[model samples]
Target chain A: MERNNDVWVFIEQHNGKASDVSFELLSKGRKLAETLSGSLKSVVIGHNIESLAKETFRFGAVEAYTIDDQSLANYRTMPYSRIVNQLVDAHKPGIFLFGATIVGRDLAPRAASHSKSGLTADCTDLQISDVKYLRVDYKNLLLQIRPAFGGNIIATIISPDVQTQMATVREGVMRLEPLEKPGIGKITKIPYLPEAFDSIVEIIEQHRQENKVNLKSAPIIVAGGYGVGTKENFRFVEELAHAIGGEVAGSRAAVDAGFVTPDRQVGQTGVTVRPKLYIAVGISGAIQHRAGMQESNKIIAINSDADAPIFGVAHYGVVGDASQILPLFINVFKQKLK
Target chain B: MAINSIVMVKQVPDTANISGQVMKEDGTVNRALLPAIFNHEDRVALELALQVQDTYSGKVTVITMGPPRASDVLRECLYMGADEAYLISDRKFAGADTLATSYVLSEAIRKIGRYDIIFSGRQAIDGDTAQVGPQTAEKLHIPQVTYTEEVLHIQDGKIRIKRKIEGGYEIVESGMPVLVTVLKDAVSPRPYKARRVMTYKNAKTLMELEKLVEGNSLLYIDQLKDEYLSKNLYIRTFTMDDLMLEAERCGVAGSPTKVHKVESVVLGGGQREMFHATKAGIGELIDKLMVDHIFG
Candidate 1:
């Protein structure tokens, strides 16, 4: 077995709590590590983040490497990336994963560039496999699969020549499955060396908005599209969502058409969603939209056009005007739940 | 110091607004059906650069790396009030991953020196990698603030920027020469000035001039390039040798990652159960969903 076989997931934390995407990566990393017959490890670098490292065990990480310092409280690109670069240089990890968040996007590319490593952004799937290219065999390569070209094509990418393969997966793409019994992983504390240059870009202020919608955690979503037609017409989607006790969402077209806000947009450009039930109303089911919601457990698409693409992934298809059908949907749901 | 800004832009396929003819029935994209335009976010970045030019005493120079046809975007940049444009094009530079592309860009930026700030879109729509800007910053050993929504102020060689975070936003301050990747909604880009458009419409890259001089014994490529440069109608075009880039480190060879496979995503049809538009059918579907605990 090669020494550089361990898979490392970077644990991201917010307000001292670990991000769910980090846990999701840990779960996904377990399968890749098992495929490679190697241990799963996680790295956490933040102030008072030892608890996050401890939390990694529940997600199947075997080792948790940590670097803690007061200066590392906020995610400054320079310091965070340098610390990651230090870890990469010292450990020579075979595969490193980061959540494709604001911090992750800022850090991963810099670290990957500095290490002269390959990094794929916004990967939806990852697997470990043997590969051959130019008549040369490479063992246990990380296959990073992502929807590129505006989600029209799914490309499987590999960094077979690089030492450490890196990928940044967005939140909710992978399933979060915690172990039945949490096994305590060995926690290794790494020293954080302070440098003056790391403070070149200083964060002057940060403001959080409370009303940020999290469609990722939504169990049921009723999404409208351009066919919902107008702001007046989009209430059909909202009424149905309220009746079903589900969140409201829309296609990129609907958002552009002012039927819904951009935060609730579901597509390649927007956030991916995997709900228990995804009811798409008046949506044509563009591939970009499908890239985000096709993974839902059950999808119901309603469109006036019977041939709408959204029906391709839906379990139930209704050919009808959203205005006509959504009232009926809301009425049935209200009666059932009442 | 007045900020001299270099904004990285690209001519990208209009992937977001793709139509039926653009996507063939076989699930592969029909190249001829795609129309290349200045990437939306990159144009916003250029608008920010032009705003920097407006407020401060500096010129905004735009750069892109693509085919000779990519010179089309450079012309658009000129029309939109860019003081200068550069096209880093070479046949060998094809199939470059983000890292390799950034390496060549960093080298080009070094050649076109004397810039206090660099700007680029957070991510291009085609690849959607968002890696090149930060990667170029790393290669150039510069600080970077990405996902920038607004540039609040620039004074005393320090720039303040408001950038989008996960839940909300944060403001950060950085010194000169920091790379800022602009978000799409950062600013509304201004339309092309009719006067500038008419003036710069004749602007051609060295490759384009070479094509113009093709099969013409009367006109020489060097002479045409010289005339165009003197008249400010030439977009500075560079080959690998022009920037002293190593052959192996400029393109596919330098890329650590490779495309192992490309599967055209074909969402299969014919599995779904169809229902009539009637209220009865709607109730029946809802009943099924509740019974399956999908919406219970």
Candidate 2:
């Protein structure tokens, strides 16, 4: 066995709570580690994050290496990156994975840069494969698969020469496996060293947006496209969403046309969603738009155009104007639910 | 100090019209089949740089690394109000993943010298890795703000930027020499000025002039380059030698990530059940969705 054969997942936490993606990474990391016949470890770095490290056992990690410090509480890229870089130098793990969250995107590149390693961003799939490049045979190389060319082509990338294969997977791409029996994992506390130049950028104020709708985790999503017309017309989308107890989302066109907020946008440039039910209203079903929600279990598309592209991935389609169709849906749900 | 901005742009094959033969076996794109255009997000990045330059009275230099045809985007950048444009093209630079590409770009930026801010698109439509800007910043040992939507203010060597997060936007202030990756919707790219287009249409890179002189022996390379330089129509060109980049660290050789496979996904409509826009049709959809446990 190689000396550094451990798979490590960076556990990201927000507001002192571990992110679901961290658990998802543990579930995924366990499989990769098992394939390599190595132990699955997780690195949790933050203030008062020992509890979160203990929680890693439930997901599947065998060892939780922690660097808890007050300065690490809020994510400042420099300090967080320095800790991860030092951790890599100490442990020399073969594979490192991070959640493709804002913090991950910011910190992974910095760490990869510091380590002089390669990092793949926003990976959708990870697997173990034997890859040969030139004269060297890379055994059990981590295959990182992601969509390229605007989600038209899935490109599998592998870091053949780098010691640490780093990748960041988007939220909800991997499933979180909660075992019936909690596994026992060792928690190793790493002392934090106060480093100079910890942070260059200072956060004056940080707050969440008012009424932030988490469309990614929403079970049911009612999305409107540009065909919905005006910003006021989006009220029909909201009414229908409220009627069915679902979140209101929009296509890129709808967001760009001022009919919806940027956060409500659902597409390649926006957010990827895999809800249980996705009802696309007035969407033309462009490939960029479908890339996000095609994974939904059930898709129902309503559009005035009978041959709109949205019907391609949808299980059910209605040939009607969303303005008229959405109101009808709202009325029926209002009467049926009551 | 007035902002001296450099905008990194890429000429990406138009992804909207892709068909089956989109990717080569090695995972670099099959660029011949599709038409190329200035990447939409990079155009916005250039527009943001131009806006900052306009406000602060500085210079906006655009740089791109691609094939000879990539000079097209450099010309467009000039027509769109860039004070200068550089095309870093060489055969050894092909098949470069984000890592190698960022290395070469960082080297070029270092050679380009004075610059206060660097602007780049969040990601290219071709690779969509979104790693180059951040990676370049790391290589240059500077700070970077990705998914930036607005530049709130720049003063006293500190720049305040509003960047997009998952659910909201965050305003961050960083010192000068920071890299910003702009979003496509950050701002509407201004149209090329008709007069600037005519004036810069004759702009030619060194390689381009070499080709021109080779084709027409009537004109000498030295005199033609001198005339173009006098007219401010000669786009700056850099090769690997010009940047003093190591041959092994500039292209495919420097790229650590190797392509394993390329799969093209085509969304199909075989399972779609069409409805007739009637009252019964709406009711049927709800019932079917409920039965499938998608709704209850």
The digit string of per-residue lDDT tens for model 1 on B1-296 reads: 56799999998888877777787776767766799988989999999999988998798999999988999999999999999999999988998999899999999999999898999999997888899999999999999999999999998889999999877899999987899999998999999999999999999998888878886889998888899989999999989989999888878998988989878876775499888778788778878987897756
The positional error of residue A162 in candidate 2, measured at the CA in angstroms, is 2.4
- Itemize residue pairs with steric clashes in candidate 2: none
Per-residue alpha-carbon lDDT of candidate 2 for residues A233-260, written as tens digits (9 for 90 to 100): 8899998888888999999788878888
lDDT of 2 by residue, B198-241 (tens): 99998999999999999997999889889898999988889999
Q: Considering summed lDDT, which 10 consecutive residues are worst modelled in model 2 chain A?
A: A202-211
DockQ of each: 0.72, 0.46
Residues A40-100, candidate 1: write the lDDT tens digits: 9998988898888888999899899898998888788999888899999998899999998
Evaluated on CA atoms against the true complex, candidate 2 attains a DockQ of 0.46
Q: How would the docking of model 1 be graded?
A: medium
Report the number of the highest-TM-score candidate.
1
Give stretches of model 2 more than 4 Å off: A1-3, A131-138, A226-236, A252-258, A267-274, A282-291, A303-313, A319-338, B16-30, B165-171, B185-191, B266-274, B290-296
Q: How many angstroms is residue B56 displaced in model 2 relative to the true structure, after the best TM-score fit?
A: 4.2
In candidate 1 the C-alpha lDDT for residue B212 amounts to 84
In TM-score terms, candidate 2 sits at 0.88
